[model samples]
Target: MNLNELRDRAYKTACDHGFHDEELSNEHCLCLVISELMEAVEADRKGRFAKVPVDKKDTIFDERTFHYQNKYFAENFEAYIKDCVEDELADAAIRLLDLCGLRKIDIEDFTEEMLYGAEESCNDETFTESVYAISTIPIRYEYEYDYPLGGQLNSMLLAIFGLAKHLDIDLIWHINQKMRYNDLRENKHGKKY
Candidate 1:
């Protein structure tokens, strides 16, 4: 329910998946998960489990997305960005818990009162240089021992995968299933959502 509990669930899931290596970074694992998700998205498009597109990279930190997220919208956007990131993070957390034999209800119990915050500082004249911030600092520091944003993202992702495991769905597997749904399939205008 807390960060430490979440971390324990995540670490155990990683170990169960055979991710053994002291030097292996959380960044590395997060990258792997994102890569897997992207690949799964592509594979679904092809109607089979294939490789991910070489070009689809992490746009979360992309220059343009960051530019907009930090610019004039800094004040108003902080909440939106935080919400989006949290959804992704929470989904990741749920997935990880699922993998660890935990149920969705269990995760809901933890999330009930999670305190999340968002702040921003911008300086770029052209883009309104701003820092779009969203965090649960207490939870982040308690689990990772560092304030790095990547840790928060990874912890959330681990939980997500764990949740997926419980539902007998790999991240990619679920994406593929979504692709089959008319509401989710790309309709030439881009993804349905």
Candidate 2:
């Protein structure tokens, strides 16, 4: 569905769940939409969310240098990428909502539908059609293409931010920070693809 349709459904669903009429109104729906956009954002405060790591080399510790001797060194790069995405991207959505005045209760009630839809669609087939899923794109270009799976997290983020405004919170500052974080390095100049 297009963004507008998803938005309408989310708002309607929130209203049905007993939020105040004005609370789940168009403005609030927009915040929920942002949360839906950033479905990767988890409410967990635990370190379970991806951990950011900085490269540190200590020649004095032979053990540190010994890691490269094993074939598993490449895996660290993968972990680094995952950490960058999980740490910065997901946190941005949550912080934006919080900054915008989205109460924990507000997020709980309004975010279920969006989050559920996103979680359900997290499958190989859906991912194969994603924007970054170029490998799944067929050589033939006759068929039209759309990214139903690529931006669920982004949708969640939008939903929450919109809802925050309804709660009387302004999150322009947080949103800007998120934009900067997301624009970080996407391509490698050397080594692995």
Taking all chains together, each candidate's TM-score versus the true structure is 0.28, 0.23
What lDDT does candidate 2 reach at residue 129?
33
Consecutive 10-residue window with the lowest summed lDDT within model 1: 125-134
- Write candidate 2's Cα lDDT for 39-137 as tens digits: 433322233333322223443213354243444433543354233324333344533243233222232333546544444444433321321222122
lDDT of each: 0.34, 0.34
Runs with alpha carbons beyond 4 Å of true place in candidate 1? 1-7, 47-147, 150-193
Best by TM-score: 1
Tally clashes: model 1: 24
Cα distance off (Å), candidate 1, residue 161: 10
